[model samples]
Target: MLNSINTNPGALLALQNLNATNTELSTTQGRINTGKKIANAKDNGAIWSMAKMQSASSQSLNAVKDSLQRGQSTIDVALAAGDTVTDLLMKMKEKALAASDTSLNTASLKALKSDFESLRDQIQKAADNATFNGISLANGKTAKLVFLANADGGSFTVNAQTLGLAGLGLSLTATFSTASDAKTMIAKITDALQTATNKLSSLGTSSVGLDTHLTFVGKLQDSLDAGVGNLVDADLAKESAKLQSLQTKQQLGVQALSIANQSPQTILSLFKG
Candidate 1:
């Protein structure tokens, strides 16, 4: 109630309240602008730190996904080539069976031999061309390929299979020159077919494994993103409502301060009277 010119308690109290309202208004405005309640360490240190750590982990999974995808592609290439070789071996078996017939003419036998050789060469070509990223799983040269599986430094190892002619125990000079030779050729072709089939199965299994893990990694990354959002994301609806209230409070605070500033003038009126 004391209205001294030098010391006005009412004005001081009004200023204090106005300053408080201004601080609240500033905080609400910041939340609205950034769309985050914990935009930085200053907002909420513990929550912000947790969100940042999870975000980094989610980003790291991107590299893991890339590695898994690359591994899958390589295996797919090998599988395709192996399948081609298997089909070629089946055709060679047909040619060899025909060549083994004792009644066949020389011209027919020569034609069968030519066809068989062409198929064998094609199988070798398939193995040679089954390369992806400089890695040929069917060429009997590449070692086991490893891909990152998760954020914990774990990995998936894809074992490579030997699918080339020599690797499959098939000699390049294997021929059907006579009935006996044709029977030997038949055995070699059958063995090669079996080997190629097994290799394809192995590669197919690895592809499936990579695919399943990739799906899991994607889901885990999504969960991490959601967790980070829960920690730091702002509720725009709530912030909007709070912003309106704070703006109104700030206006009222300014008016109250104005009225308190006029209390000193009342002392001048008292002296005049």
Candidate 2:
């Protein structure tokens, strides 16, 4: 059915083509402006799901990193206290040796006993005060730290390891009842020093091992963060190029739309002729 004056198929077809071009141009412009191929939930459901997963993983990794850092700090505090205790023990041993001398008078031996008592008090104080984040590491507390993989949901346990102070066999109590008893007491203090020294050496080894574990976990966290960034981070160069192209296409689409609207005027001129 042929119908209508001032109606031209050429003009109609051109207008339709122009409209389609305009829609395409607008879509590209939106992508350019947002710098995202899929800016909304409806754009790419699969990619959105993957991005969410990456975000969740990144959060978990960060939490694990914090846990490991606190664990390291706690271990450092314990190690430092251990070192202080060993030094005090060494000093006490020296005082014990001095007391062993027979030339020393009763007064001198009594003073040496007092010095030994003071050193023992200092060791106990160091142990009692060695804490991190309100958790004691050297006070014979049951604290342990643990690290886990992402597959395990990044699970971690704190306050699990406790140093056994009593097991180290260090006696700090004054035992000399007389000047003659000073020799035996000094020998006992020496034995305790040796035992404490061995315990401190073991603790040093454990501290080194914990530090190594922390280093490994830190590296793993870095790698996980990089992976998360790769999943969602924008490519600025590509976005910039796309913006330029979309702008040009938009301009061309506007011109094409203008030309299509003018095509109907040709039919009006034919009717006047």
Cα lDDT for residue 258, candidate 1: 99
Model 1 pairs whose backbones collide: none
Query: How much lDDT does each candidate structure score?
Result: 0.90, 0.66
Off by over 4 Å in 2: 1-35, 143-165, 172-174, 177-191
In candidate 1, what are the lDDT values of residues 50-142, reduced to their tens digit?
999999999999999999999988998999898888888899999999999999889999999999999888888999899999987888888
Question: Each candidate's TM vs. the true structure?
Answer: 0.96, 0.80
State residue 186's C-alpha deviation in candidate 1, in Å.
1.6
Q: Candidate 1 — worst ten consecutive residues by lDDT sum?
A: 171-180
TM-score of 1: 0.96
Q: TM-score: which candidate is best?
A: 1
User: Which lDDT tens digits does candidate 2 get at residues 5-88?
Assistant: 567555576577667766766666666676666666676788767877765766676666666677667778877887777787
Those runs of model 1 whose alpha carbons end farther than 4 Å from true positions after fitting are none
